[model samples]
Target: MELKNKDNNSNSGNKQINAMTEGNPVRLILVFAFPMLVGNVFQQLYNMVDSIVVGNYVGKIALAAVGTGFPLIFMMASLFIGLGIGATILIAQYVGAGDIENVKKTCQTIYTAMILGAIPISILGLFLCEPILNLINTPADTLPMAKQYMMIIFAGLLGAIGYNMNTGILQGFGDSKSSLLFLVIATGINIALDLLFVVVFGWGVAGVAIATIIAQAFSWIFGLVYMRKKYEVLNFQILKFYFNRDIFVKILKLGLPTGIQQMLFSIGIMSIQSLVNSYGSDFIAGFNAANKIDMFAFMPIQSFSNAVTTYTGQNIGAGRMDRVHSGTVAAVTMSVIVCLLALVIIPLGPPLLGLFNSDSAVIESGMIYLKNVMPLYVLLAIVFVINAVVRGAGESVVPMIGAIVTLWLGRIPSAYYIAYNFGKEYMFYSYGIGWFFWLMITGPYYLSGKWKTKSQKLIRQ
Candidate 1:
């Protein structure tokens, strides 16, 4: 009878098993990614909707104003986003290792971020808005509207910082679903407000900007609530309004590369936008529409990359090197599948482009742009997935350096040369050529197993 007592009474075993299978990895990836996909769609929708509203209601010049200002705003926003990336990575490692104390401390870094990153950018957005606009060579007709829109959006910089910080914290804790939910709610509100204010109320660009700021504020609130209620480790009581030097330095070290990468990437896009401006409004509108469509196709890749980064970060911290390797393989496989599907849908580019504008000229131009760029999705997917893996492994510096060098030295120079020396029509090649070149450069660095080695050493240090 005593020999029959074979059942294990330990709850630790059960907990470990549950943790291992919390959600099927594939299912978890999809669940985490779907909301982001929807949010991204809505994000693109708002921008596209803004263009449609303004182009049809206000005028093409206003539409161009909104479109041109996007890259500039993105450049400014990239700094905060970069800092958020740093926070996410550090939080993810702590989460993976099951270290609650560090997670709470990491959360406090948001205060540091507010002081060191957000406040400075917000001030720049307010005071330097007009001068920056002029420096970017904004057209005379569009300058006033652009300045109006930029100032209003920048006025709500605190909200943007809140959104970024909260999302990063949630993502680090393996709760991407909450972040996605907030995005969905915010995006829906944004669209409704956009229509009510811009179309019915005749508020123009300022209305659209106001709508976005309000929506972002709501997202930040929801994110805060979710963290307080759901995340057991994130303690609001410990949050200080002042900075912590050690935490600040750690956050900056991890985040600075990502921020620089984003800044440089935006700079590269601005450079291209400058070139497009020379081609006239038709090309600019077409380019903007095409870029929106590209964002849709790119959303899945971005989502997967985010998931992989978190997954890899946690596993690396847990010393589960086997899982880390497996997770990477899974991520790359998923990315390839998505990219392949995109290749089949590439021919539908014209139809998608037409949704943004019925103008035959714009549609034709967008079609040309998409058709030329679509086949490169496979390459892009590989590049993105690998970059995420690198970032997750805490080898951000190499990737950041590669991106800067490729974008500035390879892409920008080639773009200038092709557009000016070869022919304006050759500008599209610059995009493909840059991706192809960087893929080649990055592939070896990744394959050499350097990132994995470097990451192991980093964790030890």
Candidate 2:
């Protein structure tokens, strides 16, 4: 009847949804993933709408300014987001084990995270925004606009970090529904603010950035209230601002690799962005549009992957290896179906790309990127699910190593070489080739049975 026992039973392929307080893993996962997906879509929509509005109202240069700052912004925020991953896994394990004490301790760690992680990043982001833009080779014309936009976004780093931490806790506790609700609310507010500030008031990129930060702050505050009120285990008063060495080490052990992996991945994107910048603003705009579309196509797989991580962490904590296996099967199956759908639907890329731009040149370039990238969606789905499963099973090292090898050894270097030596057109091929290489490298990590052993060791230890 306990949460851990129920999780164990469910893992044995038992057909009971209500047995686990967390609910049926598949249904629970799907339901949880759906909102998260919607939220992700809306999050993308927030950016896409900004681009559409700016591209039409502000001009291509302003749009490019928004686009140029994305990698840099992501790179700055990656650490906290990566830390959230660590928090999620650890919190899920503790929640599954029904350890109220550790759960509260983990909640307190958020305070440490706020001070140690978010504040510093915010300061760094604000002070270095312009220099970073220059370093990334932002066009002289776009530099001022990019710096203006990024400065506003960075000034609100606390909101971003808070939302991430709050969402991480909710998801970790198997309450992903709340996380989704908060995101939707935030997204709605962001859109409204975007319209008011940009169109009505003529604020431009700064307007959109302010809207985003305000929404993020609202979501974080709302999520915090909910956690304190509903979850007895997460009451904020228990959140003493003290550093527990053991807790810190445990968090870093799991979180640091995932964080570094994300940071490295962002770096690779930034590297690619540098290549795109050389080609001109038209290419940059096209790349940004394609990136947004790709993110939409990728949403379901990402949602399901997060589901797998939570499902696997809880089940593994409860010593339900068989259930973990079954859950992985379900996740991978769902991911493959989504990927196939993407493969079928990607030919509409040109139309979708055109929605953001009226320019024939931008649409044409975007279509080329899609054609090269879409077929690999199927491969990426497998890679995503497998990687999630491994991480869920507490095998961070393999996934980290796989990510490093794939991005550095394959993606970034190939993108640089092809873009510089081969030609601009070869950039598309570089993207495809990098994904293919990722599939090759990461597949073995998933299949080696090493994750199972490592997970068992973690649980036993």
Candidate 3:
């Protein structure tokens, strides 16, 4: 096969980027991942602002309410999101292979699935909100607020579903720049509305929910308009979409494991959150604040991991498996460089924690949590990038199994046992311990070169 250049695939005027299928592996991956990195920063701010505004303007209890509801929200969102990940990988392969018709059909099929899937899930999600929160052992004082916050957010399920699908579409095509632009637009709106609704009007927790829903609405609308202007291939007729078993099976084969994996991952986080709730509101508030900050620090690794997916998927689709090893090396190098930024940022943990709340105890407790986890970020980066590489090779089960073991067997149990017998600080240590376990499992598998053959059997099936 001849090595293809970006000009062949990219639209005129360079409105879209085509990094993964061509260019120097290191530079291509970095340039491709940069927009995703920035977009994720703004996206993380969606959660970060919820805590900051609610904490400062309303109270710690309000902040705790927002915190308490997070894992639950993700638990619901990750189900569809897991499927979206499968769609992204498949689309990347189709795009790289230059199978234009299949790409169009797959995108329409996904939108069909989204439209059908969103209705029942939203209904089920809305109905089960309080019961699930109760099952998680949400504190009595915070129960009403958690219920309120969750209900408002889930009510806009269509918007959230639409927005994520749009982002995944751009991601599959190697157009991270357009996605970043929409996210910046959404984030600006979100922050402005958060201040107006929460601070000026005093709507409290509900204001945060309204702002997020509205921001997501903007993102989805903007994404649709962008796709219309730039990518002619993706603008398929939705009305003509019919269920094709082969395409559906192709997507589900890769998607289900990841969906289940993400759902289970959320369950694991919720499990640990339940344990955290047992420690009382201060611990919950502190952990919540600290968790928000921790997400910002970790987004780069997560962003680069997505790069590994697109990079690996496209190269494999193009029959350029030879490029993968060097690309993986580039990803790891970039991830390490990003994670090392924590060393400078973590030491000022006190003043940083002060941004959320003035309470000395909240700051101290949050600092301890951040200190334990932030410096060890590089370990998670290694694990994330490798799993992404393997998964993108069309073997999603490998990472799914790793997530099950790490989250269920290692992290959750350790967090529970440590918090119960030892104390809160020891529970924070469970994260590093779990990442080490994940690295041990996935690292050697990547080195063995067995996944290449395994993916051949899977992808062709």
Candidate 4:
């Protein structure tokens, strides 16, 4: 049963939610994405701090240990993240349509689902921690620490899930700034705790993990208070839980494919991680450090992509196909421009890698990875922007199919073959290859106008 809204304010009266259904597409997308971009950067910074503190203080092995667990953690959390994506789209649509009640229901539904879903995922992750590490061929020296780190992360899975779901809800409402503020709080707390725990207390990998979860839990709690006070529509009692079956089903239908895509993508990365692990802990740490550097290059485009998702969702919900197209162009252009700007990172790779770890071999390995990947970021930008536009229009299955084709056919197999036959240095080229294939899929789909029709159906349904 759908719950009744006791509040009398209509969607427009709820000033907290921005209506992207109007305004200039470029300006709106830029405005919307900036906070999200900063937030992503902060999130990545804390992640880098994790690597830096561990690599510098604990050892290269600890860096590799944390790195090894990341793909596995993401794989486990992917489903809920997907559901959050679904809820964001639903809420965006409802907000656009002035269906404030459904918007509230979506926020409530996804929150409840995330809280409930975290339990089994936590248990499963705990049980599989060691076994999964073994399966991934984690370096024996790193495995125990990796297992410990992962177990702590899993045990506090609700914090991460809840925090992300909270961000998704805010993003849906076109309120990206609040999410950024939350991330700022988390990042500050996390960095301080990381130094205090690992550097001061000598807790090693365990300290970093504990600091991370505490920060996330704190951020999630702060978001709740912030949202409740700032937005009446978002004010809901956490203790009183309910699920609107129809909204959940809608979320599941949209989110399941994206979840599967995330799982497959994570699995592909895990396979690549195993191959890197075969080279031992130094290479793993280098790869991890390089990945962090790469995210800085990638984050702007990614932020624009996310911005367009909400942009396209809200515009399409308002029956503005033209705005969707214009937004896509604006987002794509902005992303490519940022990608070009980010190419500056390639020349600075060695120093960047050195910041994470002082070892020469680690720096060399990271530079090799960076040189191979950074130049081709324009392709990734195009792929991500177009893909987000498709997803925003509620055509998630196509993007999922793109992931399957790209990963199975383009990235993973190519990575293994190139690494084994040519050399490990060539493995990063597979990222560009996969991204090219993704663009091939999503670009054509976007041009076909099929996604707009699908969006209409989704909105109507």
Candidate 5:
């Protein structure tokens, strides 16, 4: 009866939860993806709200300070998220196999592992933030505020890390709705706090960081309560929790590449950011505004990528390769539609950049970035959609290689060499060149049907 009530709350009367492993390919992917899309948008908006408030009120310096620290923050943050994705893939497979006990064990293990890991990470982040900022040649004007912002965010690392891991666990079981609900609640709270701390309290950059931390804490806490209430299989017993060496080993093997890929990706961006920093604050501010806008363009593909990940994870776990194939086709179609829709914002780019910061130079620079990158989003869309299938098959290393190689080998080298000799505008084109080669390298692997063999063998494990 309790489980029945939970089902009713989530699925409602006529509408049932979209089960990825057992439905029409296109419809299932869309239904499963909608809530995630909304959640991601809200997440991005919450980030945007920080810039909007800070840029409009605290000034561009504050905005620049916040923007400067983010890539560094995300570098570490993505490590945990990638680790969760590893857990998600394994859990999805276990759930698909109807191994309820193992699913519970996996959940407990991930929870325990992350909790143990967060403390050291948080401390290290706080200690490292300043040194790294200095290394990036962060301007003296912004350094103090940037350190303040980055440290506070680190102090609350548990909330951010835990929340993402919970989202991953839920997604693994095809429960996107709950994570969306939690995100909605958190984002609403975040927006309200943004106004209170930044405007009402005059806390500036620190205020936004505080708001984000509290909001993340709310989501993680609420996620725990919900899981305990709804899932008998999700109950966390301290005494029952022991190191599952086998599960931990599996999670690391499949997921470490993802974590490495993201860390290296962020490192590559940091490398570029170090160069961007040398140009001065106006350029940094403009890069931030353009990146904020770029998130809107990229978020859809990310949403679809996540949907495909969950879809492929669940279906492959259920031994439904046919569903995986059809779903990939549908995901690619959805991705193209989203990429086209994002283009509408391109012509509106100048005004949007201006909204973030009214400086003429900042506006013009940001517009250049949007115009160059946004049009080529379709190429990016193709790589993301196809990679989703590859990752869901637990062939994470393959895509990870494709990503790191493209960034370090292609994007980084080209960006630096071009900027050093010719100019920066040409450097932006390297973004496309990188994606094109990435697609060329990875797209064929997907078509070759190698991942299908890997997925088939995974079931036997």
Candidate 6:
């Protein structure tokens, strides 16, 4: 298996994305993960800005109104997002093995699928918005604004979906830096527009939604142009769409389980959201703000986990199982170190929550959630990085099963039981409980070495 030096081809003028098959595992993983971490932070800002602007200008009800729509949006997008992850995994493997031809085919297949799928998703989402909100028992005071914000967002779903697909495609190439650039563009635009629409023009929730969609649209289109110009393999002709049946089948096999997992995860969050809603608008706003802050603690590990996936994929494709194992160790170690940041974040909870809204009830409610979940963040870090390694090895189903066991069987049910019997304040404990279960499931499977054999059939394809 003589490998090509294609990933570092200077003559090809496409060395923008580095190959992970060479270099020190720890250093390479760190270098790859850093840009992605920065990008993830900026990406999180889109929502953070929305929350900040809406909570300050339009009031608490409006803040809750915007916050209430997130789970539905994520739920709606989860399937496609899963497919994107599948595409990323495939691309990383192809990049690792220097399979440039198949990488192009994957790009074509997933892009065509997303474009065709976005149409029906947007229309169907519009019709389902109010009904789903009602089903979730969204607070009455927040319902109208939530519905308005969501419908507008659904109409612009293509922008968000497209930009994310772009990220996934680039990520598969092990090109985290370019994705960071695109996110920076989107985040800057979002912040500027958030101020303009929500505060300056006083458009409220609708304004924030509109700004997000517009920013996403711009970033997606800009990324497309950049990729077309920079990477020969990814120079997809937008109008000249091609759907490779074989590639589509392969992607479906890898993506469907992950898609189901993501959908269930979103459903689990939505379930907790409904419980939060029952406590009133202030609690909902608080939970939303706290959740945003939680992402900052989680972001570094999440970035490393994503890097682990690519690291594992490339090394597996290169038939370097030893490097894959070493990479996993490096990634887990990095993640644990990063998770200690939660200690700092927990003590600063009140100040952080105050960034969204000045209300004492909101801040107090947020503190309850941070205290419950932050200390146990290490459990999630281990689970996530380990599962990423498994998934990158083309073993998607195992991670999907872990998600099912964690979210559906563990977290959601535990949240409901505690909220009903004990109190809503105790419900956030369900997250740590779920992460423990996830670690329990993931750690054993990795130790068993079962995942190494899990996806050979797909890889051989």
Please report the candidate that would top TM-score against the real structure: 4
| Pairs that collide, model 5 | none
For candidate 1, the lDDT comes to 0.73
If scored against the real structure, what TM-score would every candidate get?
0.90, 0.92, 0.94, 0.97, 0.94, 0.96
lDDT of each: 0.73, 0.76, 0.82, 0.88, 0.83, 0.87
Q: What's model 2's lDDT at 348?
A: 80
lDDT of 5 at 398: 84
Global local distance difference test of model 6? 0.87
Tens-place lDDT digits, model 6, residues 108-224? 989999999998999989999999898888989999999999999999999999998998888888888988898899999999999999888989998989999999999999999
Give model 3 RMSD, 1 decimal: 2.8
Where does candidate 3 clash, by residue pair? none
The residue-by-residue lDDT of candidate 3 on 218-276, one tens digit each, is 88877887786777766665556566667778888778898889889988888888887
Error of 1 at 48 (Å): 2.8
lDDT of 1 by residue, 274-322 (tens): 8777776667777777877777668888888887777767767667656
Candidate 2 lDDT tens digits, 398-439: 778878888888878887887778777767676657667777
Decreasing TM-score order of the candidates: 4, 6, 3, 5, 2, 1
lDDT of 5 by residue, 1-461 (tens): 01122123322221222357787888877877888888988988988999988988888888789999887888877768778998888877765655555666778888888888888889988999999999998999989999999999999999989889989888887778888888999999999999999999999999999999999999999988886666666767633556687787777766888989999998899888887788788888888889998888788788888888988977787788878888898989889998898898878888898888898878877876787788888999999999888988889888998999889988888888988897776567778878987898899999999877778565455
Q: Number of clashing residue pairs in every model?
A: 0, 1, 0, 0, 0, 0
RMSD of 1: 5.1
Better of 2 and 6 by lDDT: 6
Off by over 4 Å in 3: 1-19, 237-241, 454-461
Q: Which runs of model 4 end up more than 4 angstroms from their true locations?
A: 1-13
> Which ranges of candidate 6 are over 4 A from the true structure?
1-13
Candidate 4 C-alpha error for residue 117, in Å: 0.6
Model 4 residue 327 distance off true place after TM-score fit, in angstroms: 0.6
